[model samples]
Target: MFSKIVIACALVALCQAGFLHYHEAPIHYSAPDHFTPSQSYEAPAIHDEPAHEDHYVDEYAYPKYGYSYSVEDPHTGDHKSQHEERDGDVVKGEYSFLQPDGSFRKVTYTADHHSGFNAVVHNSPPVIHNH
Candidate 1:
């Protein structure tokens, strides 16, 4: 039993000595010769300029469509106006208006629909006055 104790003590002492030696060993490391310590960065100088007048631009300088409007009167059953739309090669529109002489004028328009287009306007003859 005494021999076993002595052997264990010797093993513990050897292990401790080896651990200490490894931790105490000096480590060597060196930076490359071409590398230099970075210096503090300095911002570049800027020159101020005088303020200028504000400029404005008109995005909608032109109208999108030629003309568009509508009117309706329930009492007289009088109504007029039209709208036109174009899709691909087809265009169509219709419009009608009541004249001051109690007459009605109607217009129809069509273009590029099945490779054909036409405009027709219907208006009554002007009333002749004997006076």
Candidate 2:
């Protein structure tokens, strides 16, 4: 009628200045509270750790041991030595070497189970290098 009343007064002044609102202007946030888990809350009981007993020691995993070694050399005038011992069924020892024309030998031995073995050898001569 008059441009339909001027388009209804410009849509009522654009809905009173809210410009026909497409929503975005009502924020009042605070966020720092959220642990919601309640139905009269109740949960704290876990026990089962108290039962230990195990021990067995017999004290004899080889009871005894012995060892010895030696060697001497002045440019091929070789010499040697050995020693031994044991604490079960008895066993004693001695040894020596060097014999390739440069003679030298030694041996002293023993055994147990009622002296079932024995040895005693000694020979030494031929190591004269008056150089």
Candidate 3:
């Protein structure tokens, strides 16, 4: 009686496991007949106009505002760095580095007046910053 009961319990457990592991087939519905196929239409071809060699300027010419960076020495302990701007407003500024995991993590001085900073992390909503 004991052996029979043990075998029955084992069979029940195995059956439960199998049932839990089973996956149902995904049901996919076909598009309606009234739906028009997008590939049936063709885009108009663009014709190349004659190139104006005389109107061409040097491609390597420098612009008015140049991009540059100034790095401060860590001995001075100055956290204030150049501010990043968007549409003439300070979006982010006062950058500092935190070495939590051998990589430099950026710490920005965020203002309540702006939108927010954003950073992407796995399984979590991205970090947002506005100033």
Candidate 4:
């Protein structure tokens, strides 16, 4: 029992000695944040592709059956013009328009029974502006 008491006292002394040797890390206070209000942004100018509409269809095989090309899309072709023409059973056209997210969507399509309706769409990422 006496040995147990001495052991307990020695353990406490050892703990205190270890505690005295330990040192706390230095503390530093950060500077307060300062932010400036953002400025209003202006819109960028849109450069839409011009129309290349043909007055009449030109075809060696069938001039009368030849189709003149042009399509005004309701969704994205507000001020944009598309190219389209019917070469007998086959039809082809291309058009481009701006997106709401400042991206560009261009589509080239062809339709026929042999190849079916095929559309090749090209998408461009939006450009960021700093104001």
Candidate 5:
């Protein structure tokens, strides 16, 4: 019980310190007294740009991500995998799993501007055991 209490206190202190470290102090600003209306300083004149003038800017951006995961059967020493990704207007995904008879099955998906959408599946032939 004492050790638990000590660990809890240490965790609380660490969390408090982390919060304080990441916190930012607010900024306070004030204009100098010399800029008040009583001073003779004149404000600068402003000019407006003419409209209908063309301004050009170009940008290229895309998002792409992919990750894979696997689950293993601790007793059987077998595993399955899954993955997915998306780039710009295209997306793809897949998953594969092991079968009980020493075979694997895989399924996939794809979509894009031209092909629209499609799904494909493949299966490994079941293992044949001969006596």
Candidate 6:
């Protein structure tokens, strides 16, 4: 009786596997000769100005959530840009700059996701009057 039951189960399993294989589509294969390889070409040379002592400076205001952080170049009694980020969070920070017109501009960044976010304080420097 046990042998009969085992045979019956095996037959059912075999039927199911056969049905699945019968319904499955055949694999499609393409020969490598059908593909066209791209030709090798040299890229155009890009000219960029050489970096100097004051070429570029960046700063960041990291989050205080026990996450790893780094500040490239913080306020050094001079003008510079800043950026900061926390784990699984969009980068948030502020930038204060002195315009070429001898005025100051303050910009605050709040949760800058790829979509975008609110900018509470966005003020530009007022025109300076040279006496």
Of the two candidates 3 and 6, the one with more favorable TM-score, higher being better, is 6
Give the per-residue lDDT of model 5 (tens digit) for 1-131. Answer: 99999999999888888433576899999987775456577888998967787778666667788888999887975779999999988999999998888788999999999999898999999878989
Better of 3 and 4 by TM-score: 4
Q: What is the lDDT of candidate 4?
A: 0.77
lDDT of 2 by residue, 13-97 (tens): 8888853558788989898888978779667898898888787888766635789998898797677889989778788898988
Task: List CA RMSD, all candidates.
Answer: 27.0, 25.9, 19.0, 25.3, 14.4, 24.6
To one decimal, what is the Cα RMSD in angstroms of model 3 from the true structure? 19.0
Best-to-worst ranking by lDDT: 5, 2, 1, 4, 6, 3
- Whole-model Cα lDDT of every candidate shown, in order: 0.78, 0.84, 0.51, 0.77, 0.87, 0.62
The C-alpha TM-scores of every prediction are: 0.34, 0.34, 0.19, 0.41, 0.44, 0.30
Best by TM-score: 5
Error of 6 at 109 (Å): 1.2
Which pairs of residues collide in model 3?
114-130, 114-131, 115-130, 116-129, 116-130, 117-128, 117-129, 117-130
lDDT of 4 at 17: 83
Candidate 3 lDDT at 21 equals: 75
**Residue-wise lDDT of candidate 6 within 10-123, one digit each (tens)?**
998888884334567789998776778789988999999788675555666554543233333445435545454445566566666655565666666666456577565655
* Regions of model 6 farther than 4 Å from truth: 1-78, 112-116, 124-130
Per-residue lDDT of model 1, residues 1-63, tens digit only: 999999999999888885434556798999877968799888988879888889897675432
Candidate 5 — number of clashing residue pairs? 0
Writing each residue's lDDT as its tens digit, candidate 3 over 1-131 gives 99999999999888888434778999999987797667786789999998867766668643223222446557754422343434233343444342323244454443334555543322223345567
- Total backbone collisions, model 4: 0
Clashes of each: 0, 0, 8, 0, 0, 2
Cα error of candidate 3 at position 30, Å: 99
- The TM-score of candidate 1 is 0.34
- Model 4 deviation from native, Cα RMSD in Å: 25.3
